[model samples]
Target chain A: MRGVVLHGPGDVRVEDRADPRIVQPTDAIIRVTAACVCGSDLWPYRGVDKSDEPAPMGHEYVGVVEQVGDQVKTIKAGDFVVGSFFASDNTCEICQAGYQSRCVHAELIGAIGTQAQYARIPLADGTLVATPGPPDAGLVPSLLTASDVLGTGWFGAVAAEAGPGKTVAVVGDGAVGLLGVLAARQLGAERIVVFSRHADRQELATEFGATDILTERGDQGVTQLKELTGGLGAHSVIEAVGTQQSMMQAIRSTRPGGHVGYVGVAHGVALPGEELFFSGVHLHGGPAPVRRFLPELIGLIWDRTIDPGKVFDLELPLEEAAEGYRAMDERRAIKTLLRP
Target chain B: MRGVVLHGPGDVRVEDRADPRIVQPTDAIIRVTAACVCGSDLWPYRGVDKSDEPAPMGHEYVGVVEQVGDQVKTIKAGDFVVGSFFASDNTCEICQAGYQSRCVHAELIGAIGTQAQYARIPLADGTLVATPGPPDAGLVPSLLTASDVLGTGWFGAVAAEAGPGKTVAVVGDGAVGLLGVLAARQLGAERIVVFSRHADRQELATEFGATDILTERGDQGVTQLKELTGGLGAHSVIEAVGTQQSMMQAIRSTRPGGHVGYVGVAHGVALPGEELFFSGVHLHGGPAPVRRFLPELIGLIWDRTIDPGKVFDLELPLEEAAEGYRAMDERRAIKTLLRP
Candidate 1:
């Protein structure tokens, strides 16, 4: 089987690998129908995160189950499904509390590596949510999004308490941040603000119901947000970029007693406790428990209530995986979908 | 009028001062019935927070309104009231949102120096909540507690989301921390764990309904809490000390998706964003908006539903304010109440 592998920094390649098989009773083998390069993948590609040996790449996927182990009861062969980046045993106490990312026996599906022809997923019954049927070709990218980004954006909005009469500000213009604007609108936020400097992304943000677009960054961005919010700052701030500057902007843009839902994976940042304390804002975010919102997101995708698939501006065949990674890394594509 | 003044570290003295008069249309003059030294006072007393000159000390007080400006409508002369350490116009967006500490026009009473016999309170109509009537002498301490410590502890419990079926861990054994235990119990927490090493404070914590008392500090304290909570950590953790160790312990002791309500004034602590992001916990705290809880807390005190006054282990006349400060500094008393 052929799969995406990274030999070193900026060294993505499609290489032949041994086919995956169900090795545990709780595992299921899925034939990857669609996969994508995530924003997080740039860390290693840009040499920010070092890798010693060749590593498997993708985590987001929508696929058809090709095989199942003896203990997998809910998922079966030939079933169409969408699974989260992390595999969680839904029966665990943490998962039952709606925090699947912290499940007692959770496993990172990317380590198993979903950017391949066939992949074995652990805790199949809990990790994979079966779709109604084989989705149309047009519905592929949106369902693939539910596997991670869309579900994460929805969770971020919910965590920030973005709902009716609330003004929400999103701190990043990546695919996840764009989807956050959509989620905030769908959640009934009265005003949506997206911080974007790019003309193309700004148009998409407007289409997602963003009422305001600020071209500024950092402190200036906060100042603009306050100016638009009657000088009190937004009721909710979504932090989709995990950097010191972005985090500070998100925190500062939120009004006192307001919520900041941050889903960005923090690379290397430290928050001063004194500033956070004096800010008097509620802070709640982490590795989003995407599993908690997958069911609803899948429904929305099926009913055509949202079209998050617009984020996939570039597509490539599995054999041309390297180009897909290059395009996303160069900002030539918002998201790149790969057809297996 | 006489007031407590700190000439420098270890230089607390009661000195004659000019009587306070309403300085603003929204101000009210109060004759302080009771004032106390707070844990925060030790900051400047120990010279951690420098003061260039002899500064007035004390922020917690319960008093009788002696005069009111034309704009003061809700309160009047002769009314007994308990006010927060910070004055806030309750109708502001931030105050209405329950973060009066961050109110746009908030005034720090202590910074303005409130230990004087006669103190001027700004935003009087919004900051002071009057009791039903003149209360029995025994209610003085409890009402004074409500002015700051008890209200702060209650806010911590509410911010941490302590409630029925949840396990709560309190990370400081000071007056506010002990009161947090009482607040957790009143809020219906099933299991309350308090980390305390002092024998007297531990006993008081137990009396306040701490089902488990861990004498360990830092990581060990978190381990003890987790051991008692079936290895999953507490559902709610209240951080009453603003040090890095206490903050880390509070964060580590809370389960994923749990809440940490920290009300301790952060001295010099930095929170690593990566760890917090992976912890998947909700964090909220600050100088508590005590005014928001004043009415209910007053009712609880008047009806004897709670007895937070037990926190004051020593009492002295206004003339001996120096001894009151010394007693608290020497750890001979949890709290000291000075009567005028």
Candidate 2:
């Protein structure tokens, strides 16, 4: 099987690797139809998150099930499905409470590297949701996003309590942020504001239901968000960037008693306890329980109710996996899709 | 008039000061019937929170309305009332959203020194909640607790979503933390766990409905809490201590998808964002919006449903204000009641 591997910082390669086998009775092997580079992947690519050895690359994918372990009752071979980046038993207390990403017996699918011709999925019945049938080729990218980004963005919106009568502000212009704007709109938010400095991203954000766009960052962006909401700040804020500045901005741009839902993979951010305490905002977010929302999101995608696939601006063949990483890292692509 | 003043760290004195008068058209002057030393007072008394001048001390009080400015509508002279430490014009959006402490025109009543013979309360109509009538002398301490500690603890419980079938854990054994246990019980929590090192405080916590008592402090405390909750952690955690250890303990003790409500006045706490993010817990708290819960708390106190006054283990005349401070500072008293 051909798969993507990271040899070191900024060193991505597509090479032949041994095929994955069913290691557990709850596992299933899937022939990946498509895979994509994610914002989190850039963490190690930029050497911000270190690795001791060569590590497998992607976590998001859309694929057709090729084989299933004996104990995997709900999933079977030849079924087209999407699974969360984290494989959870879904029946654990945490997963039942809607925190599958933190399930007691969770596994990061990234370790299996979905950016390959075939991948093994654990907790098959709990992690993967099969579509009604094979999705249209045109809907593959959108279905792929439901594996992570779309579900993550939706979780951010829900955590922020974005709904009718809410003025939601999103901080970040990445695929997750843009999709968060769409999620907020779909959740019935009265107004959506997104902070973006790029023309292309801003336009996409606007199209995804952002009623207001600020080309500023940090304090200035918070000021504008507050000004737009009558000096009270937005009712909900979605922080899709994990930088210290972005976290603080998200916290500051929310009105007292509002909520902040942050989904960005935090690095060196240290929140000032005093400011957070005084902010009087509810803070809730982490690795999203993407598994929890997979079914509904797949339904939405199947019916063409949302167009999250538009986030993938660059597409490449599996052999050009390095180019896919380069484009996303250099901001040339909002997200990149690679056909396997 | 006489008032308690902090000349510097460890230097508390009872001194002659000018009596408070109505300063705003919406203000009311009150003859303080009872004032109590608070855990927050120890911050400055211990020199952890520095000040440039001999600041008047005290914010929690139950009093009789002495006079009202022309525009003061809800409160009248001769009426007995209990008000929050932060005066807010409750009509503002933030206040209406139940975050009166962060109202656009908030005024910290502590600045006017409720520990004095007379204190001026701004936003009288919004901040002061009148009792059914003048209460018996025995109820004074309890009503005073409502002005701060009781209301703060209740807010913590409410913010943590303490209710039926929920396992609630309280971190901190101060008056507020003890009251939080009471609040959780009243809110129908299935089980209550309190972390306390002192025998006296632990006994009080048990009386306040604590079902489990852990004398451990930091990591050990969290471990015991997890062990008690089947290793999943408590469903709701009330954090009433603002130090780094207590904050981290509170966060670590809550299960993923659980809630942490913190109300202690933060001093020098900085939350590690990455840890908080991956913790997958909902965090909501700050200077509690005591005014929002004042009416309910006062009613409970009046009906004898809760005896928060028991927390005031020491009583001192106005002239012995320094001794009252010393007793609370040295942990000789859980709280001290001062009569002017």
Interface CA RMSD of each prediction in angstroms: 0.7, 0.7
What range of 10 consecutive residues in model 1 chain A has the weakest lDDT sum? Answer: A109-118
Question: How accurately is candidate 2 docked according to DockQ?
Answer: 0.91
Residue-level lDDT tens digits of model 1 in A1-340: 9999999999998998889987999999999999998999889988889989999989999999999999999999999999999999999889999999899889998787788898889999999999999999999899999999898888889989999999999999999999999999999999999999999899999998899999999999999989998899999999998999999999999999999999988988899999999999999999878888888999999999999999999999999989998998999999999987
State the lDDT at A319 in candidate 2.
Answer: 92
Clashing pairs in 2: none
lDDT of 1 by residue, B174-231 (tens): 9999999999999999999999989999999999999989999999988888889888
Ten residues in a row with the worst lDDT in model 1 chain B? B109-118
Candidate 1, superposed: residue stretches over 4 Å from native? none
Q: What does candidate 2's lDDT look like per residue over B78-179, in tens digits?
A: 999999999999999999999999999999978878888989999999999999999998888899999999999999999999999999999999999999
Return the lDDT, model 2, position B217.
Answer: 84
lDDT tens per residue, model 2, A1-340: 9999999999999999999999999999999999999999999999999999999899999899999999999999999999999999999899999999999999999999999999999999999999999888999999999999999999999999999999999999999999999999999999999999999999999889999999889999988888899999999999998999999999999999999999999989999989999999999999999999999999998999999999999999999999999999999999999999
